[model samples]
Target: MPWWVEYGRSFFPVILAVFLLRSFLVEPFRIPSGSMIPTLHVGDFILVNKFTYGIRLPVIDKKVIDIGVPQRGDVVVFRYPPEPSTDYIKRVVGVPGDRIGYYDRVLYVNGEPVTERVKAQALREDGQEVLRVPEQLGEHRYQVQWVPQRSSRQGEVVVPPGTYFVLGDNRDNSKDSRYWGFVPDENLVGKAFFIWMSWDSQRFAVDWRRIGSAIP
Candidate 1:
C-alpha cells in the first residue's frame, strides 16, 4: 500500500468523529464582543449544544432535522443575517408571532411586561455605569446590563414566522435585532450553554469566576 493511503486510513476515523461531533453534538466558540455581558463576557470561551435546535450541516448551516425550537430567553448563537459568515450571540427575546416591545429599557412580550429588577451596578473602564438588571423571560432568568443616559433603539415589533427577535445583554450598546431585523430560523446555529474558559482581555489574566459557568 502507498504511504499516503496508510496515513489516510489511520487518521480517517479520528477526523470523522471530530467532524460529526462538531456538526451535530457540540462546538466551541469565543465571545468577541460584550453583547452578552454579565451572562457572557468578552473573551469567554463557550460550548454550544449544536443539536439543541436541530442538526445543521456544518458551513452551509442548513437544518436537516427538526429537533427543537428556540425559546424565550434562551441564550442563542446564530449567523448574522446581513453577513452570514459572521456569528453572533444573543438572548431570544421574541419567538415567532409574538409581539415584543421595548421602551425606556423595559421589555414587553405579547403586551405583558417581562419582569425586570434592578439589582446592582458595575462600572466600566470608560467610566460608564452599567446597571445590573435581572430579567425573567418566561421560564428562564438572566442578568442584563443597562447604561443609564445611553441612548438605545426602542420600539415594538411583531416577530414573524420562521424568525426570531434577539437582543444583547448590554442593552444600550448592542446592535441586535432591533437594528438589523429578525434572525431567520435557518440562521440559528445552536444554544449556548456553558463557559469553558474566560480571559480578561484588559487584565491579561484568567477570570476564574466566569470559567465553568452555565449560560442562562
Candidate 2:
C-alpha cells in the first residue's frame, strides 16, 4: 500500500470511534452562564450521559433508540428551543402532562407547591441579598438561589406530551422555560451527571473543590 494510504487507514478507525463515542455515549460541555448558579457555576465543565435519555442520531437529534425519559429535577442539557443550534442546561421542572407554575419565586407542579426550605443567605456580586434554598422535586433535592427583591417573570403552563418544562436554579436571573417555552423531547441532548473540572476566570485559578463533583 502507498505510504499515504497506509497512514489514512491506520487513523480513520480511531477517529471514527471517537466520533461515535461522543455522539452516542457521553459528551463534555462547559457551563457558560450563571443560570444554574448554586448548582452549576460558570466555568464548570460537565459530562453528560448521552444514552441516559436514550440514543439519538447526532446533528438531526432524532431518537432511534428507547432508553429513558427525563424526570423532574434531573439536570439536563438540550438544544435551546428557540435556537436549536445552541445548547442550554437547566433542571427539569415538569415532564409530559404536568402543570408547572412559577410565581414570586415559588415553584408549583400540578398545582401543588414544591417543597423548599431556606438554607443560607449570601450577598451577590451586585450586593443583593440572595437566599440559598433546598428545593425538592420528585426524588431530587437540590439547592436553588433566589433574589426576592429582583423583579422576575412568572406564569403557569401545562407541559404538552413530548415536551418538558425547565428552569435555571438562579430563579431571578435565568431566562428559561418561563421565557422561551418547553423543550421538545427531540431537542434533548443528554442528562448532565458530573463536573469534571472548574476554572475561575475572574481569579485565573482552578477551583480544586469543584473538580470531580457529581451534578445533583
Candidate 3:
C-alpha cells in the first residue's frame, strides 16, 4: 500500500474518536445574551453535559441511540431551530407530551398552573419593571421575570414527542420556545449546570460574583 494511504487509514479513526468524545462527553459554550440572566449572565463561559439528553452525533446532530429524555426544569443548551449554528440556553419548561400554556403572564402545564409567588418587583437595566415569579417546578424552584405592558408571546403548545419547550429566566427579553418552536430531542446539545466565568463588556469588568455559580 502507498505510505500516504496507510497513514490516512490509521489517522482517520483516531480523529473520529476524539471528535466523538468531545461532542458527547462535554462541550464548551459562551452565553451571548441576557436571556438566562440571573441564572446565566451574558459572557458567561459554561460547560454542557452533552450525554445527558442522549448521545448525539457532532456537526450533524443526529441521535443514533438514546440515553434518556429531558426532565422538566433542566437548563439546556441547544441549536436554535431557525438558525442551527446559533446556540441558545434556556430552562426546560415542557417536556414531550406536555400541554403548556401561558396566559396573562401565568404559566400552566397540563392544565394545572405551575404555582408561583411574587419574590420581588424590580426595574431592569433597560428601565422596565419586572415581576419575578419564584415558582416550583418539580423539586426545583427558580425565578422568572415578566414585564407588565410588554407584549408577551403567549400561546398554548402541545409539545410533540421527542421534543421539549424551553424559556429563559429573563422571560420578557428572551427569544425562546414561545417565539420559535419546540427544540427537537436531536437538537439538544446538553444541560448547562455551572458557570466557570463571566464578563460584561458594558460593565468593563469581570462579574466576580457570578463566577463558580451554579445554573439554577
Candidate 4:
C-alpha cells in the first residue's frame, strides 16, 4: 500500500470513533454568556449528556431513539428557535402541556407560585438593587437573581406539545423564552450536567475552584 493510503487507513477509524461518540454520547460546550450566571459562568467548559434525552442525528437534530424528556430545573442547551444555527442554554421551566407564567419576576405554573426565598441582595450592572433567591422546581433547587425595580416580561401561556418553556437563572439579565418563545423539542441539544474546566480570560488564568464542579 502507498504510504499515504496506509496513514489514512490507520487514522480513519480513530477519527470515526470519536465523531460517533461525541454525536451520540456526551459533548463538550463552552459557556459564552451570563444568561445562566451563578449557575453557569462565561468561559466555563461544560459537559452535556446527549443521550439523556435520547439520541439524535448530529446537524439535523432529529431524534431516532426513545429516552426521557427534560424536567423542570434541568439546565439545557438547545438551538435557538429564531436562529437555528445558534445554541442557547437555560433552565427548563415548563414541559409539554404545562401552563407557565412570569410576572414581576415571580414564576407561576398551573396557577401555583413556585416556592422561593430571598438568599441575598446584590447590585446589577446599572447600579440597581437585585435580590438573589433560591427557587425550587421539581426535585431541583437553584439560585435566581431578580431585579425588582426593573419591569419583567409577564404573561401566562400553555406550553404546547413538543415544546418547552425555559428561563435563565439570572432573571433580570437573561433574554430567554420570555422574549423569543418556546424551545422546540427537536431543537434540544443535551442536558448540561457539569463544568469540566473554567477560564477567566480577563484575568488570563484558569479558575481552579470551578474545575470539575457539578451543575446545580
TM-score of each: 0.93, 0.93, 0.84, 0.92
- Per-candidate Cα lDDT values, in order, are 0.88, 0.89, 0.82, 0.89
Model 2, residue 69: C-alpha shift (Å): 0.5
Tens digits of per-residue lDDT for model 4 on 70-176? 99989999989999889899999999999998876778888887846545556665466777778889888888887777777889999999999999998988999
* Clash count, one per candidate: 0, 0, 0, 0
The pairs that clash in candidate 4 are none
Cα lDDT tens digits, model 3, 1-216, are 999999999999999987877778877789888888667777999888887877766567688778877788899988888998888889999998899998877789999877474555566666766776776688677888777778887789999987899988888889889988899876778888888888888899998988898777
lDDT of 2 at 95: 97
**Candidate 3 lDDT score at position 202:** 84
Error of 1 at 124 (Å): 5.4
Q: Could you say which candidate leads in lDDT?
A: 2
Span of ten consecutive residues with least summed lDDT in model 1: 116-125
Q: Which stretches of candidate 3 lie over 4 Å from their true place?
A: 1-21
lDDT string for model 2 (1-216, tens) is: 899999999999999998999999999999999999999989999999999989888777678999999999999999998888899999999999998888877789999878465455666655778888778887788888888687878788999999999999988889999888889998899999999999999899999999999888
lDDT of 4 at 139: 80
* RMSD of each candidate relative to the true structure: 1.8, 1.6, 3.9, 1.9
